[model samples]
Target: MDYTAQILKNPIFKIVGEAADEMQVETYVIGGFVRDILLKRPSKDIDFVCVGSGIALAKTVASRLGNARVNVFKNFGTAMISYKDWELEFVGARRESYRKESRKPIVEDGTLEDDQNRRDFTINALAIGLSKHNFGKLIDSFDGLKDLKRKTLRTPLDPDVTFSDDPLRMMRAIRFATQLHFDIEPDTFDGIVKNADRIKIVSKERIADELNKIILADKPSYGFKLLFHSGLLKLIFPEMVDLHGVDIIDGKGHKDNFYHTLQVLDNTADRSKYLWLRWAAILHDIAKPATKRFDKKAGWTFHGHEDKGARMVPKIFRKLKLPLNDKMDYVQKLVRLHLRPIALVKENITDTAIRRLLFEAGDDIEDLMKLCKADVTSKNDVKVKKYLSNFKKVEKKMREVEEKDRVRNFQPPITGDEIIEAFNLRPGRVIGEIKEEIKEAILEGKIRNDKQEAWNYMLEVAQKKGVELN
Candidate 1:
């Protein structure tokens, strides 16, 4: 098929074709750039495969395009050019062979067909010609266009061989399936299941990168289900795997936390496109397995799951090689407070409770509310409606409380320095105690979060503590 019109729209393809003609090497635009073009998805990264030296082709193209900087990787026989907003990568058509012990491939220059054979999936193997004679002619030897139209993910070659060559393809398969809303061909999916253990050879950084893409997809639950069924989830994240199954004790059963968590993740994805909020949904009930217990009367209970799950966030982040930063802390905080708003549903919600939640969640209160709402994965429409309705009331109370008390991210109106100086005392436990009392009062709605109110309350407490003013 000719994509000449579409290919010609980008001036770079012409420059590359001219450069390839000058260098007398066959060059073509291949891989994701072509796939996305046909799918009508926007893409800025373009990969070019040439029969000869890709670095030389890149340099020739760069020189013609006002001599843009060409970053060359000698060992990999590849080069990259940054022109305007586009990233143009040049690589020689090469075939790869991997050893059993590592994912790093043994590489040697080959033809365009050899390069296509090495691609992870059929849709990605599609290429468009950029040479003078064959300009815009597609080279789809694997029927990738048919697979794309069918919304099916399939390996270019034998699924086993394609996966065994590089196990990271397993994650990429699921990631692409999730991103494109496609299904993995049965054989291709079975290949992932068969070679699931091979994923261990891939580094955590690459795995985490793929996982993040899946999480940020329109529906992350699908990718996670694929991962769980393929047995990759257990290998990469055993703790989450432990959340699976229903433990029935004497006709009492708890929900399947693993699937519930997936629902929460999907719910959060619909509400917000933020990654960390989705992470919060994933970990909110992580400790349920650890904290699970049963009583004859009360049935199953994960009593301290929230608090325990909060502590598990850092450890999970470390194990997954995720950044141990404020992002992790944000997820942890949401996990800890997920149940607070729900608890308010059963009773007359108070302004003091709202104040405390606002103070603790700070600017993340909205995100926390989102995670909490997503946590409602009940199949019972009535129950879900009741819980969500109560949340709206809670949010309304929070706004009223915040406007009245100004308590979000609450700061102490009375400083410890003021207390110590007023009491004519040095820095000691008494100063800290005095400050704590004032903070508690502000959060409890006993004080207005006002300087004068806090000052008056501080003096009254100091007098009661038998600490006379100087």
Candidate 2:
């Protein structure tokens, strides 16, 4: 198939073809750019493969494009140049062989066919000719166009050979399926399950990169479900897999926290696209297995799972090599407070409770509420409706309380320093007690969240503590 018209339209392609001809080397646009164009997906990055030195081709192209700087990686035999918003990378076509213990390949320069054969998936093996002789002809030996038409992810070569050579491709296959909403060909999927254990050879950073792509997809639950079925989730994230089973006792069985968590994640995805919030949903019930207890009255209870789950976030993030900063903290905070909104819905929903929750949740109050709302996934539609209605009411109350109290990210009206200065006392337990009392008084509406009311409360507490105020 000739797509010469498309390639010729781009000014950079003309320069690439002219440069390749001058150098007497063959060049073609290969891999993702070609596949994405055929699939009608927008891609700004293009890959160019040459039978000769890719670095030399990149330099020549860069020179022809008015001395555009070429960034070369000699070790990988690849080079890149940035033109406007597009990134073009050039690499020498090569064949690869991998050992049993490692995913790193022994690379050697070869023909274009060798490079296409080394591609992880058929859809990514398509190449568009960039030579003047047959510019725009698509060379697709693996029937990648057919796979694209079928909306399937299939390996170009033998499934086991392809995946075992570089186990990270297994994760990429699933990730691409989730991103494009494409199906993994049956044999390829089976190969993934069989070689799931090989994923350990890949680095955590690379694994996390693929996992993040999956998490950011439209329906993240779909990717996670695929991971679970392929046995990859158990190895990569045992904590999530731990929430899988349900134990029965006395003819009463609790809902599978695993599936329930996925439902919440999907619900969160529907409402918002914040990656950390989605992570909070995935982890909100993560400690259910550890906290699972059976009582005579409460057949099965996961007491303090939220708290335990919250504590587990840092460790999990560390293990996965995810960011250990505020993003991790955000997930942790949401997990700890996910149950608080539900508790308020069941109880009297007092101003004091709402104020505390608002203060603790701070800027994430809205996200926390969204998560709590998504948590209402009962088979009973009426119960779900009731919970949703109550949540709306709670949300209204929260806004009112937030406006009245100004308690979100609220700082104490009376700082500990003020208490110490007012009471003529040093920094000690007595000052902390007074500050706590003042803060409690403000939150409980015993006094207004104002300086005068807080000062008076401070005096009262000091007086009760037998401390004289200046």
Candidate 3:
């Protein structure tokens, strides 16, 4: 099909065409940009594959664009240029062969068809010609347009060869399916399962990157489910795989934490787009397997799982090469406190409890609430309704307490220096004790969170401790 009208609209295409003609080489805009255009997904980055030296084509294109700076990667036969908020990447068309032990391909310059054949999926193999003779004519040797119409993902070449060459493609396959809400072809899906172990040859950072993309999808559970079925999760993230399965004793059983976790993840994804929050959902009950217990009275108890799960977050992040900074800490805090708000909703909702929660969660209070709401995954409709109603009440109370107490990220009105002055004491344990008492009194509603009340309370505490102020 001719997309010449569409291609001509972008001035860069003309520049690229002229550059290719000048260099006496054929070039085409290929891969993701073409795939997204067919799927009606907006994309800004374009990939250009040239039958000759891609670096040369890039240099010519850059010079034609008034010497726009081009970043060249000689080792990869690739170059990139940024123009008009669009990133255009150029690569030489190449064929690849892989060894059994590794996923790295032996690359050699080839024709445009060879490059298309090397693509991971049919949809991604679509290309738009940039030659003056066939400007904007689509090159689809693998019927990528048909796959786009059917909402299916299939490798451009044989599935085994495709996945074996680069095991990361398995992850990419699942990610694409999740992002587009499409189905993997049955043969391709089976191929992923057979080649699941090949993923271990890939780097953890690359695996985590793909996992993050899958988590960001509209219904992320789809990707996780595929990963689980394909055995990739067991290889890459066994802790998550450990969450699978249900056990029974004396005809008593508990819900599968794995499925429940996925439900929570999907629920969170629907409500919020924050990556860390979705991670919190994924890890909210991660320690259930480790902490699982069964008693005659209680069929199953994952008591303290939240705390254990929180402790597990950092190790998991380090292993996956995820950021070990505040992002990890944020996910850890959410995992630890995930059950607190829900417990309050179930019990007597108190202002003091709300104040403490608000104070602890601080700026993340809203996200924590969103996570708690998403955690409501009862199969019983009536129970779900009851839980939601109670949550609404708890939320309303939290708001009221937050407004009155202003305790979120709140600091004690009485400072350590103020305590030392009021109690006629030096910087010692006595001053710290007084400060703690005053802060607790305010949080517990025994005294107003104001300087006057705190000062009076401080004096009372000192007097009780037999420390008279001069």
lDDT of each: 0.93, 0.90, 0.90
Q: In model 3, which runs have C-alpha deviations exceeding 4 angstroms?
A: 2-4, 417-431, 462-470
Q: Model 2: which residue pairs collide?
A: none
Worst 10 residues of 1 by lDDT: 1-10
Score candidate 3 by TM-score against the native. 0.94
- Looking at model 3, report the run of 10 residues with the lowest lDDT sum: 1-10
Residue pairs in clash, model 1: none
Over 4 Å off in model 2, which ranges? 1-4, 423-426
Residue range with the least summed lDDT across 10 consecutive positions in model 2:
1-10
Q: Which tens-of-lDDT digit does each residue in 1-470 have in candidate 3?
A: 44436545888888899999988899999999887766668889999999999998999989988899999999898999998889999999999889988888999989988998999999999888889898878889998889998999999888988998899999999999999999999999989988898887999999999999999999999999999999999998899999999999999999998999999999999999999999999999999999999999967998999999999999999989999999999999999999888888756678888888887788898899889989999989998898888888888898899778878878889888876776567788888888889878988989878888888888899889998876
Q: TM-score winner between 1 and 2, please give it.
A: 1
Candidate ranking under lDDT, highest first, comes to: 1, 2, 3
Per-model clash counts, in order, read 0, 0, 0
